[model samples]
Target: MQAQILNLMRELQRALGLTYPFISHDLAVVYYISSRVAVMYLGRICELAETAALVERPRHPYARLLLDTIPDLEMSGRDRAPVAGEVPSPIDPPPVCAFHPRCPHADARCRSERPELRPDGGAEVACHAVEEGRLP
Candidate 1:
């Protein structure tokens, strides 16, 4: 039923040459409906790219983590690492990288400096680790 509705919506959008911004935590749905995607973290657009590009080659750690949370039928027997840690308070956010406390690649620089959204490959990503080639 949901798939049917989504297909109908897409058809209508195409017929009318309309753009609809569909926001959801459901990665599969986002991948199905969107031409482009923007990944946000701590009220910032951490990564943005075409859906295929974003799904296949996410540059930001947070975006990658979100993709990893999608359940895979092939990995049925293996344990999936769940998205770790709570979302930081937007009202009183961290000074440096908001993801520093949870990020595995966080260094002194990440803890002290904030990263800007910069063009990386086909997407825009905000991560000092990515900018420094520490993560691919």
Candidate 2:
């Protein structure tokens, strides 16, 4: 099974461009096969950046939580905060920032509206906290 998967990956690499869109929720696979990564939540892209950069310094809250869950020797020494609540249904996402419901940094404005994917530093984030410069 592993050999077949590897063979397929090699074939794909040869056939596809250097930068191809490999969509999957498996971070390990993504990290192994792609140079850049885009983290999405509730059908919306929460963050996009270089794989290492995004994993090391996640900009969006969801991205941060997702990266925090990745177990690594270096990261194992650090404490991880739990991601609160279940993911909301994509068919009925919140008005503003679909992640606001479970976001620890969410505020009043978050529930009332959805945030846009605005350029921040090197990636785009769709959180009111990030839009308002409230997220650290």
The Cα local distance difference test for each model comes to 0.84, 0.79
TM-score of each: 0.87, 0.83
- What are the per-residue Cα lDDT tens digits for candidate 2 across 1-136? 9558856886777888444677887888888777788788878888888888887788888998887777776644776777786677888887677887688998788878877788888877777787878876
Model 2: weakest 10-residue lDDT segment is 71-80
Error of 2 at 122 (Å): 1.6
In order, what is each prediction's RMSD in angstroms? 2.3, 2.3
Per-residue alpha-carbon lDDT of model 1 for 1-136, expressed as tens digits? Answer: 9999999999999999989988887888898899999898778788989999988787888887787777776865754345666667889889889998778778999889989989988888889999999874
| Model 2 CA deviation exceeding 4 Å by range | 2-19
